[model samples]
Target: MHAKRKTALAVGAMLAPVLALSLPASSASAHGYISNPPSRQAQCAAGTVSCGAITYEPQSVEGPKGLTSCSGGNSGFAELDDDSKGWAVTSVNRSQQFEWKLTARHSTSTWQYFVGGEKIAEFDDGGAQPGATVTHQVDFGNKTGQQKVLAVWNIADTANAFYACIDVNVG
Candidate 1:
């Protein structure tokens, strides 16, 4: 073989593995969603609520860090934005435990909970990577009756966050 051709082939082979290792993991495999209390996306994935693409990928509702939309402004998962979609309302006490089932752990900044456009609670992780599952006991305060709670997982390394909206009837 020509010397130049042989050198080029060797370089390509050496770079292949490095390139592969630098690629990001699949989004679906790198994110998470609320499981307990059953967030809207969770309902879709569990077939409790009929949905589109979100039905297969509940952990992928990611968007800019401060977005309030349940679908994370992702048009493909717009069904989550429809308050009239008949999402099952979970009945719970005033102080509730919210559980997040993480597909892959990620470095976190903070976990925020919102209701009626007001931040009800926030947990700071100090940019540490979380475990396979995370749970936060959030007090509903004076708020009660039917409410839509928005949960956001802020990633420390990125300017984006994962979102889940859970409908609940607090007793």
Candidate 2:
């Protein structure tokens, strides 16, 4: 029995690296949110807004790349999808640097920013995995007043994207 246990340990040690390599990079990429200007989730995570489950895992509010729901269709975090949440609106400019607190990194396709349903800026990562954090400075052009910035982080290896909805009063 001791010999058998030693053999099992030897085999298990050899497979650990291979197993870790095969896991999707985005699996732990789960916890991430807009931190600089603070999205609704960010606000909740920071205690500026009272939220339910989303306040606990703000970084996990992810959904498909093309979807518009802030909840990412996650019922547990459905409060993010509500437009009447009284989320604190951050004041920003026509050109502002948006920052994300990435708990894990993944190969990225592109980062898109939208205002009032129109694409304002898109940053292509060229299929490169990002570092611990990601930032994109955008120019809103002629847009102003209360606007919701839909930031989408498209994973290069997956068909899904991480979503962050930042409400800002553009000045």
Candidate 3:
């Protein structure tokens, strides 16, 4: 019995490091969403935009890079893609500031804003970790009328990004 106990202890000791090393790596910033101008997901949670699961986890709109969809190209957030859902449209000027509320701050590569499939603006973080919140100013140039803006938060050292869609009326 003593020999068996010693063997088990040794096995556990040897496995501890391996188990720790095998654990999944976590994102430096786990979750975040656009609040000002109110991203689709945020509005959903606020009850201003009717949605499904996104209403529960608005800050978790994570997906691979290059997704232009409002739902981050994720089916779980498909409600964001439905224009008929009466998403609250925020009125904005030609130049506007967008606020990102991060529950977990992660290393960031860049922040991009797109309108009608065109890149309107981008802010580079240069591989540095961001703060609890980030704000970006966007200029619409000459574009006007109702716009669906797709915002992307590119994570440094990772292939993933956080996406948000903000509907706005720009005059």
**Model 1, backbone clash pairs (residues 3+ apart or across chains), number:** 0
lDDT of 1 at 8: 98
- Taken over the whole model, the C-alpha lDDT of each candidate is 0.96, 0.86, 0.89
Lowest summed-lDDT stretch of 10 residues in model 1? 23-32
Question: Residue by residue across 1-171, what tens digits does model 1's lDDT show?
Answer: 699999999999999999999998655445899999999999999999999999998999999999999999999999999999999999999999999999978899999999999999999999999999999999999999999999999999999899999999999
Tell me each candidate's TM-score: 0.87, 0.82, 0.87
For residues 126-155, what per-residue lDDT tens digits would candidate 2 score against the true structure? 999788788888998999999988888888
lDDT of candidate 1 at residue 97, scale 0 to 100: 100
Which whole-number lDDT from 0 to 100 does residue 118 have in model 1?
A: 99
As a TM-score, model 3 comes out at 0.87
Winner on lDDT (1 vs 3): 1
Per-residue error for 3 in candidate 2, Å, reads 18
RMSD per candidate (Å) reads: 3.1, 4.4, 2.4
Off by over 4 Å in 3: 10-29
Error of 1 at 3 (Å): 5.7
